[model samples]
Target: MMNKTNKILIQWLSWPIHVRIALIVILLILFFGELISVIEPKEFPTAFDGIWWAIVTVSTVGFGDSTPKTHAGKLVGMVTILIGASFAASYFAILSAATFQKQQAYVDGEIPFKRKNHVVIIGWNEKAHEMIQSLRAVKPFKQIVLIDHSLKEAPLMENVHFIRGNPTNDFTLLKANVKEADAAIITADQHKNELDADMQSVLVLLALKGINPSLYCVIEILTEHQANNAKRAGADEIIKTYQLTSHFIMSSYLAKNGLSTIYSKLNPATGNSFQVLPVPENLVGKTFKEASIHLLDQESILLGIKREEEAKMNPPLSYEILAGDYLIVFSH
Candidate 1:
């Protein structure tokens, strides 16, 4: 039984730092009492008497259960009291520090995008790279940040920053600055089950709304039901990827035209290929004809106009440009 007790004491000593520190302090008081008894037998006549005295003094119980009789013994008891107080204070300090670190990490994870100036990406996946490429083509100079955990690289672009954590984490949402983003594009990560992707997209939308009530949020969904859910999550726009892909594919098949052109333009090998240019707010009063002339001069073709709530593909030359219109231009 004595050996067993020794083994248990050793095991406790080997525990984590905080645990060991606490144990060491308790043992220190015990050892001090025992040593005093051995050197000055009058201080503690027996092991039971020494332990009883320690318990009463350290606990401030002062039960009068046992009392140190020698001057040396009383001094040892005083030292034990100080040690116990110090250990209690240190324990609380360590616990408070740990708690603060957890709270700080949560704050860092919230979406950081703000200012109606940065690109806000919601979901993360293999396709995220391609989506980012598209955004780059449209707004090469804009700041782009990604919000997702699965991505080891949230913002792969040189000017981009990554949230580097889960989208649902509130801190992750604030870190992305969801409120100040120029536009938020939520895409589903590539997954075998389309439903899972849709759910993630919806979750991102919900997180964004909680952070910024007025922030523009776009979500991608695989099904109609998912789309409805995304809308309920406060998404301003929800794109049904499969449905749109089917439409595009069917149209391409009927026309006997391959999607290669569409693919290459959106996924250009050259960095200088297809691009999206936001019309200068100052140029909003200009007619589309003027914008077309400017684009042609730059050796680019104007494909369409993207406004606050409307995307007009292949708008007429006479169409009037607005302050926030994003002109879709294709260049070499």
Candidate 2:
């Protein structure tokens, strides 16, 4: 019998601290309730009445309807108050501390993301910040994860999880749950020179693809020479930042209202923007002219066709649209 009792005690000690504290409080209440009933049999007629008085006394909610009539019962009430109040205070204090610690860990970017199908953005910059804001505006509930090595605290944003670590590191990518992510955008690191930044972006792409070969990656390349390298490293789309900027600058210099027209058309907030859609079943096996006419009827203009990985702008009217082809249309 003694050995069985010792084994039970050891198991109880192994329980969580909060569970132990809770059990002790309950046992004290039951013990004092039974003691008070025996001491003042007339005052607490039923066992339930004794338990009620004990609860009221411990909580300091004395209703005065039930009270200890004898000196012994009053002494027992005092003991219940002291012990119960202490345990209650300890439980609440521990609960508050735990909640605060969890919040602190999240702000410090120490929490690992567990959700799937989120968009991962690598490197923090003005471009990334703008992209996040734009994505939030378009899809308010889209999940986004930001990975950066230099940040000391996560950015305060809804639906955005932050992982503070080197983007090129495999562990960091895993922490962001990149293996299950839908897509990733690797922005050029602003702190490095043009060539070095491109190289770093390519390295991050390689790490991301190594973990999830099916992950769609869009990377920004500053130098023209590194564009091919980024593509070879498993980047689905490459954004040539310098070349795009140069085209816009030259256009603005040549035309009086070049950017104004282009910006207005590109802005989705203006109720019209470019949209990539799958080729409709009816459009398959049809000529480009027929596809353009069909899109025109729907208040859209067919700009180009994306076949597999290659995109052709304004293909010849006789060009045939095949199944699995995507259409790039300017829609209203």
Q: After aligning candidate 1 to the native by TM-score, how far in Å is the CA of 154 from where it should be? A: 5.6
TM-score of each: 0.48, 0.84
> Which candidate gets the maximum TM-score versus the true structure?
2
lDDT of each: 0.72, 0.89
How well is each residue in 1-332 modelled by candidate 1, as lDDT tens digits?
99999999888767865676667667866776676667557757776666666656666667775566677767777787788657746766776886786555434443344544788776666566777877676668778787766654334356666676777777766667666777778887775378887877787778778888888877778878888888778888778888988987887888786764765554554544645677876568887888888778878888889887677997787899987779888887
| Candidate 2 runs further than 4 Å off | 1-16, 33-65, 258-273, 315-324
lDDT of 2 by residue, 1-332 (tens): 99999999999999877778877877777888888999999998878888888778776778989888788988998898899868867877777887798788888887999999999999989988888977787777889999998889899989999998998889899999999999999999999999999999999999999999999999999998999999889889899999988988888888877565676456564567788899999999999999999989999999999998899999999999999999999996
Candidate 1 vs. true structure, TM-score = 0.48
